[model samples]
Target: MQKIDYREWGVDTLFYWKLLIGLGIIVALGGLSALYMEHEGHWVTGMTNLVVWGTPHMFAVFLVVAASGALNIASIGSVFGKKEYKPLARLSGLLAITLLVGGLLVLVLDLGRPDRLLVALFNNNFKSIFAWNIYLYSGFMVIVAAYLFTMMERKANFISRPVGILAFTWRLILTTGTGSIFGFMVSRQAFDSAILAPMFIVMSFAYGLAIYLLVLMFTFAQDNRVIGDNLIKRLKNLLGLFILGMLFFTAVYHLTKLYGTKYHGVEYFFLVDGGIYTLTFWLGHILVGMLLPLALMFCPRFSPSRMALAIACGLVVIGGLATMYTIIIGGQVYQLEMFPGMTVINEGYGTEVAKYAKYCPTVPEFLLGIGGMGVALLATTIGIRVLKFLPETLADESVS
Candidate 1:
């Protein structure tokens, strides 16, 4: 193994200071939002009994799942002997750890009683998917951080292989746990399917790869790091394949729902009647997010530049976020009728029900979500600068 000295990978002090300033601002804004939520209660946000967990929760979950997926390149290289992925290993590892921390922060702050967050950790609900997710996420974080540390230590060759395997195993379990969180919600028609778990697993790959590509572009642009065009093209090709898989799963899931008697009404409302949410799912998620980017990457003439890749990545991420939002919100849009005897169903039976149980996130919630993104970016930037995680110089020697 060839060792690169930390001194050779140092970032400029100006960039480091700027990152700190950005982090500080984000922290201040998040703190203020938390305080406001605490004082005013959960009423400040769009959350109600009907929509107990809203956009913030979806964003947090997406980030964590995406983070785990980002680490796959490193995990695959170390455990599965895929040497081509080694170049991305260090950056992906750092990103995985940082994004998990950021996601956890958003989740903790969004809690009605942030102090009671420990209840989820201490209380054991063996049957509950949410309970399992808590454990999985914590375990994944530990394993990934340990693996990252071992990788960072040039002298620690013997431990890296074992740590890498552990990280990879735990991340897979963690993603499954995340998927099961929604899958086990039997009461919700949108999430009751067995396919959601696998769907989320695939989604993790799409989001993870997309984020890694974007980060690569940003790092290269800012620091003049020499990532080969060939590498970028390879990643884009892989991403295109994942996008196809994601689209397939999405289509089959919906098509199967339409065929099922239990879920038909809910499926119809989301696919046809649900207004902006439906539009978002069909156009934003399916067309722009998946198909268009796939075309840009896979089409020979349409091979994207670094800037174009970044834009595509951003669109994919936005679409992924919207997909999650639609799932969570769209599920609740239709209310089930408790009264069985009524001939004419209530106006609130389908898409109309969401209007009554309405939720538009308050300014505070939006600010907090924005702050989370800031925190994630600031953390990544600082890690690159000070932690010697991102390589500043390309190694001439082959990775062992």
Candidate 2:
């Protein structure tokens, strides 16, 4: 067996420092946005009583879900014993931790009362999916941290397999819990489906892998490291498979809902009459996010090009945000069927629930979301720089 080599990123300090400064600016803007929302209240943004989740939730959920998926690379190496994937394991673990942290930061800050996080920590409501996630999120951080330790520390190398297995199992449960957050909401027409749980698991796989690919490629390129075509091909193919799986679940979800007369109205809203939401689903989520990327990846002409593969991964990331936006915002905007078979009439003074709730995210909300990405990238870059997370070379010969 060829020995593997791992090393910290020892790239140009000028570029490294510039990257950190740019990310710091983003983080700072995100903090300012949070402060603005906290002081002025959610009213300053697009959120109303009808649409509570808003753009921040969209970004937060995407980051959180993607975080679980990012760990898939490491899981493939350590748990599944895929030797080709082993060299990437350390960076994978780091991305998982940083992504989750970035996500949770947005989630907590968007609460409007960030201090109440302390209350959530002390309070236990096992019945609530939200509460269950508290433990899942915290435990995920701890477990992945240990998993990284096992891989990085020579003394703990013997137990890497057991810890890797544990981390893998925990992430699955964590994602299941995340999906359940929406699925368990029986009152919401858009969310009340068992398919969402597994669908989300698949989404994490796709989104996480896409982000991982982009990061891997970009970092490798930045350092002039030899990331050969073979490794890129393997990762891209995996990404394509995951995207296909997610699409399948998506079809089943909507099809199952369409099968029932009870859900027909909501289905129409999402698929047709919801205007922007429908367009977002078709254009942003399906066509751009899934189809175009799929073509770039699977087509004989495009698939072989390194630039094409990178573009596919980038498109997947964009499509993921669009998917979340449609799910989080579009789901909330649709009027709920609180009283079936009865029409609701407006009596003025906020008494009547409009047919569709309105939401237009403010600048601050966008900044906050962008900030989360900034945090994730910043942390990831720092991790690679300070520690031996990246393999020295991912050339065909070395990785094989």
Candidate 3:
């Protein structure tokens, strides 16, 4: 095995400081937004009885799931013995930690009762997926942290493969738990399904890899580090494969629903009549997120272009958000059927059960969601600067 040298990000101090300051401002604003919502209550935000989980949940879920996905690079290198992937493992581990932290921050802050966080943390209710996630999320961080230790410390190098395998299994479980949070809701028309667990796992793969690619490119470019074409090709191809898997699971989910008479109404709402939700489903999730990215990755003309791959990754991210919004918010917007045949009318507002629920996210809500990204990037920036998380170079000779 050829010795590979690792180094701290070599960007100038001024650029690093500027980036830190910018990220700090975003994180500070997100904190303030959370505080504002906490003080004013859920009334200040867009959440209601119908749509309880709004934009923050979407962002939080994306981050949490993506966090698991981010570790795939390290897993591929250490567990699967892909030498080409070994050079990027450190950044993968760091990103996995930071992304989860940023996600958990948003989740905790948005909990309406932030003061009761300790109670939720300590009180283990085995029945709830939400409760299970407390353990999953914390355990994932600790395990990945240990995994990173084995990779970084020369004395601990012998245990890296075992630790990598452990981390890989744990992340799959974590993503499953995250997805089951939605999948277990049998009462909700939109969430009632068994496919969501695997669907979420596939989603984590696509979203996480997309984020890893963008971050890898940005950091490598900033420091003038080389990322060889072979590595880029592998990553882009992997991303496309994940996207196809996501689409496959999605098709099965909707097709299964469509086959059942009980789910016909909800399927109709998503595929046909549901206004913004339908648009988001087709344009945002299907076209931009899935199809466009696949085109960029597999198409001969665009596949060779780094800029094109970047755009595809960006589209995946955007489409991921759209998918989350349609799933989280749009799911809630469609009213649930409490009675199989009877229509319940709201006497006060003269609204029928068939009427869709209304929710519009406020500015503070957007700020809070955006802030989570800021937190993740901020930590990533500082982590690479303060430690040897990034490799000095990834030229073909070094990687292959």
Best by lDDT: 3
- Clashing residue pairs in all predictions, respectively, total 0, 0, 0
What's the true lDDT of residue 238 in model 1?
79
Candidate 2 collision pairs: none
Off by over 4 Å in 2: 347-353
> What does candidate 2's lDDT look like per residue over 212-283, in tens digits?
999898888898998878888889889999999988998999999999999988899999999899988998
Tens digits of lDDT, candidate 1, 1-400: 4444332234467876776797879867976887898889998898877778777776788788888889987987899987766656888888888778777788888988898987877888888877777788788878888887788777886798899998888888888888887777777777877888888888888899899889777776667666666667777877887898899999999999889676766787788877877887888778877987776676666675666677778888988888877887767655553334443334543555333246677877767766776677777887776666665544334333
What are the lDDT scores of the predictions, listed in order? 0.76, 0.91, 0.92
TM-score of 2: 0.98
Cα deviation of 75, candidate 1, in Å: 1.6
What is the C-alpha RMSD, rounded to one decimal, of candidate 3?
A: 1.4
- Give Cα distance to truth, residue 261, candidate 2, Å: 0.4
For model 3, residues 299-397, the per-residue Cα lDDT tens digits are: 999888999999999999999999999998989988887777766666244444446788889988988998998999999999998899988888888
Q: What's the lDDT for residue 108 in model 2?
A: 91
TM-score of model 3 relative to the true fold? 0.97
Which regions of candidate 1 deviate over 4 angstroms? 1-12, 337-356, 394-400
